[model samples]
Target: MSNATNPTAEDAPPTTDEESVSVGTWLTVFGGVLGAFIAVLNIHITNASLKDIQGALSATLEEGSFISTAYLTAEVVIIPVTGWLAMVFGLRPYMLFNTVVFALTTLLCASAWSLESMLVFRTLAGLAGGTLIPLSFMLILTLLPPSKQAIGMGMFALTATQAPSIGPTLGGYLTEAFGWQSVFYLQIVPTGIMFLILFQGLKKTKPQLELLKNGDWFGILSMAVGLGAMIIVLEEGNRKDWLESDFILNGTLLAVTCLITFVVIELKRKDPFINLRLLARRNFLLSNLVGIILGLGLYGSVFIMPMFLAQIHGFNAMQIGLVMMWIGLPQLIVVPIVLRLMPHIDIRILLAFGAFIFGLSCLLNIHMTADYGHDHLIWPNIIRGLGMPFIMVPLNVIATAGLDKEDVGSASGLFNVLRNLGGAVGIAVLATFLSLRQQYHSSHIVENVSAYNPFTMERLQGFANHFGNLGADPILAQEQALRAIDAIARRESFIMAYNDCFYFMGAAFIVSLGFIALMKKPG
Candidate 1:
C-alpha cells in the first residue's frame, strides 16, 4: 500500500492521513473559520456606529456603553465551554443550532427600540456567535494533519488578525451608506452563507450523550461566572475608575475568587471541563503567553489608532476606516508568502522575527506630533500587517504540535480565552495610561505658561490680534486668545500621551520576545 494508507511508514508525518482529508472537510474547516471571523467582526463592528445608535435609542453615553459591554461579557463567558459542549452535542448540530441563533439574534438587534432591548439581543447574539471561535479551532486540529495545517492556520489567522482590523472600516462604511441599523443588517448575508456552507460541508455524527453524566458541572459554573465577571471588570474598569467604583471592586473580587476555585477544581478532576494541564507543556504554555502579547498588540492598536485619528484629526468614521484599511488589507498578500516560507525556516525564528517587526511598527509611532495624520500612519500600519501573518500561523502551529486529538478541544479553548482576555485587559490599560499621561503632560506644559512670561504674553497677543481681525471686540478677542493657547497646549499634551501609549505597546512586544525564547521548534 502507498504511504497514504500506511501508518507505519517512517517518513510519513505524525498526524491523520493527509489523503483522507477530503474536499468536504476543507470546506467545513474554512466555513467554520468564516463563522469565527463574523463572530469577532461583530465585537468591533458596532463600535464605529455606537454614537449614532445611542442617539437613535435616546440613551446617555454610559447606558449606551452596555451595548458593546454585554456582547463582550457574553462572548468571553462562552468561549471556554464551547469545546466540551460541541463534543456532547456533536459538532455539526451544535454549530448549526448556534449559527441560526446567532443570525436571528443579530437580526433582532437591528430592530431594538431602546438601550435595554439592544443589550438583551446583543448578549444573546454574543452567546450564540462565541461558540464559532473555539469550535473552528478544534475542527482544524482534528480534521487536518500536520502537513496541511498551515493552510488551515492561515484561514484562522484572518479571524484573529484581520477581523478586528476590518470591523470598524466595514461598520463605518455600512452605517454611513445605509444607516446605523445596517451594521446589524450586515450580518445577514455572511451568516446566510456560513449556515449554508456548514450545513452542506459538515458530516453528521451521533452525540456523545453519555459524556454528560461525567461532566464537570461545578467547574463549568465557576468558569462561566468567573470569566464573565472578569470580562466586565476589564471592559468597564477604566470608565468606572477601577476599584474606586463599588461595582468594579465587587466584580474584581468575584472574578478572582471564582477563577481560583475553578482552577483548583479542574486540577483535581478526572476529566476536567477544560484541561488546564495543557499549560504544563512548555511550548503550549509559552505560546499562550505569547498569545496574550499578540492580542494586546492586535486589539490595543486597533482601539487606539482610530481614537487618535478621530480625537486629534477629527476624522469621520469613513475617513478613519479608509486609513485602517492599510492595516487590514495587506495581510491578504502576506499570508501566502508567509505560508511558503514556513516550510523552509524554523517556526520559532519566524514568530520571533514577526514579534520584532511588530515591535518596530509600534515604536515607529512613538514620536508623533500634532501634525501627524493619514500619511504618517500608513507605513507603520502596513508593517504591522506584515508582522501579524508571520506570528499567527506559526504560533498556532507551534502551540498545537504533538498535542493529542483528545486534548485539542481544551487546548483550543485555553488558547483562545487567554488571547481574548489579554485584549480586554490591553484596551483598558492603554486607555487608562493615555488619560493619565495626557493629564501629566498637560499640567507640566501649563506650569510653564504664565501671564508673567514674556513669550507667553507675545503668543497671546498674536492669537488676540488674529481673532480681533475676525471682528471680535478687544476684550473678547483677548479671552478667545487665552482659550486658543490652552487648546493648543491640550492638543500637544494629547499627542505626547498618544506617543507614550505607542511606546508602552512597543516595549511590551519586545518584552514578549523573552517568552518566545522558551518555546521549542514546532515538531
Candidate 2:
C-alpha cells in the first residue's frame, strides 16, 4: 500500500513539538509591543506638556485640547478599516507601511513650528499608531495557543496600560529639562528600533481580500461620516458651549442626521463597517454595554482627577504622575495573576465582582478633600487596578466568544470603537458638567452672601486686617481682601463640583453592573 493510503503511516505517533522562540517571532513581538507602547505613551505624555506646548505655539486652551482630540479622532476613525486594510495589503506590508508612516510623522511632529503643522503631524501619527494595538492582538491570537494567549495579552496590556501612567512622569521631566518637543523626540528612538526589527524579521502573510469581494463601500462611507461627525461634535461641543454656539448647533444637527442615516443603511447593507448584526448575539450586545460603561467610569474619573490635582491641590505634572503610579503598579502586579486564574474561574462572577469593586473605587473619590494626599487615593486605586483586569479581559473574551474566526476582526474593531466613543462622550460630559456645576455653585455662594450679611462682612473685615498686617496700603488691603474672598468662594464651588462628579461616576459604575450581570455565561 502507498504510504499516504496506509492507516498506520497516517496515525503515526506524534513527535513532541518543542516550543522555542524563533528570531522572527521574537522580532515581531518586540517590534509590535514597542510600537504599541510608543503610541500609547505619546497619548498621555502630551497631558503633562500641554502647558508648554500651548506656550510654545501661542495656542489657546481649546486649540491645545485639539492636539489630543485630533490624534484620538484620527485613531478611532482608522481602527475599523484595519481588518480590510490587512486583507488588502497583507500583514507584513501593512505593518511596514504603518511603521514608515508613523516614523516619518514623528519626525514632523518633533520639528513642527506651528500648532496647525503639529496637529497635522499628530493626526498622521495617530492614523499609523491606531493599527498597532488591534494588529498586535491579532498577531498574538494567530501565533499562540488559547492557553498561552492570556499571558501574551497580559504583557501587551502591560505596555498599553503602564505606558500611559508612566508617560506623564517622563514627559514632565523631559519638558522641564529639555523642551516640549522632547516628547515627540522620545517616539523616534522606539519607532526606529521597531522599524529595523520589523524589516528584518516580519514575513508576508496571505491576503484575505476575497472576504471583501462584496465590499460595502457605501456603508463604510456612511459610518465614517456618521462616527466622525459625532466625535467632532462631542470633542468640540464644550469648547464652543454646546448648542449655544451656532457652530456647535450645526455640528450637532449634522452628526445626528449622519448617525440616523448610517444606522438605517448599516441594517440593510451586506457587509457593514460595524456589522450591527453581531449585536443580535446576546453576549456581544451585553459585552459592548459593559465596555461603554466601563469606559465612562475609567475616563471620566481620570480626567477629573488630574484637573483637581493641578487646580485645587496645587500639584505639578510630576506630582500627578507620581500619584498615578500608585494606580499603575497594582494593575501590573494583578494582571499576571488574573491571567493565570481566568481559565479556572467563572468569568461572569468575576466580571460582576469587578464591576462592584470598580464602583466602590469611584465612590472613594467622593471623599477627596482639598487637603488630601497621595495616600488618600492608594487603596481606591488598588481596587481600581484589581477591578480592571477582571472587567477588561473577560469582556474582551465575551464580546468575541460567539464570533467565528472570520468575524473576530470586525467585532474587535466595533467593540474598540464603542469603548473609545464612550470615553469621548464621558470626557465631554464630565467637563461640561463640572463647568456648569462650578458656575451654579459659585452663583449660589455669592447669592447667599451679601453686603448686609454679618458673616460676609465679618470675613471681609478679617481678610482686610490680615492684608493690613502684611504692610499693604489701605486701598490695596481692601482689594486684596476682596480677591481673597473670591478665591475662597471659587475653591468652595470647585470642591462641591468635584463631589458631584465623583457621585455621578459612582452611579455610572453601579448602573454598568446590571449590564455586566446580563452577559451570557460561557459553558
Using TM-score, give the best candidate's number.
1
Candidate 2, after superposition: displacement of residue 82 in Å? 1.1
* Per-residue lDDT of model 1, residues 127-233, tens digit only: 99999998888778777777888889999998888888888888999998999999988888999999998888776767767778878899999999999999888
What TM-score does each of the candidates earn? 0.96, 0.90
**Candidate 2 structure quality by residue, lDDT tens digits, 450-475:** 78999999999999999999999889
lDDT of each: 0.87, 0.75
Task: Assess candidate 1 and give its TM-score to the true structure.
Answer: 0.96
Q: Which runs in model 2 stand beyond 4 Å of their true positions?
A: 1-33, 196-201, 206-214, 451-454
**RMSD to native, candidate 1:** 4.3
lDDT of 1: 0.87
- Scanning candidate 1 in windows of ten residues, the lowest lDDT window is 1-10
lDDT of 2: 0.75
What's the true lDDT of residue 508 in model 2? 84
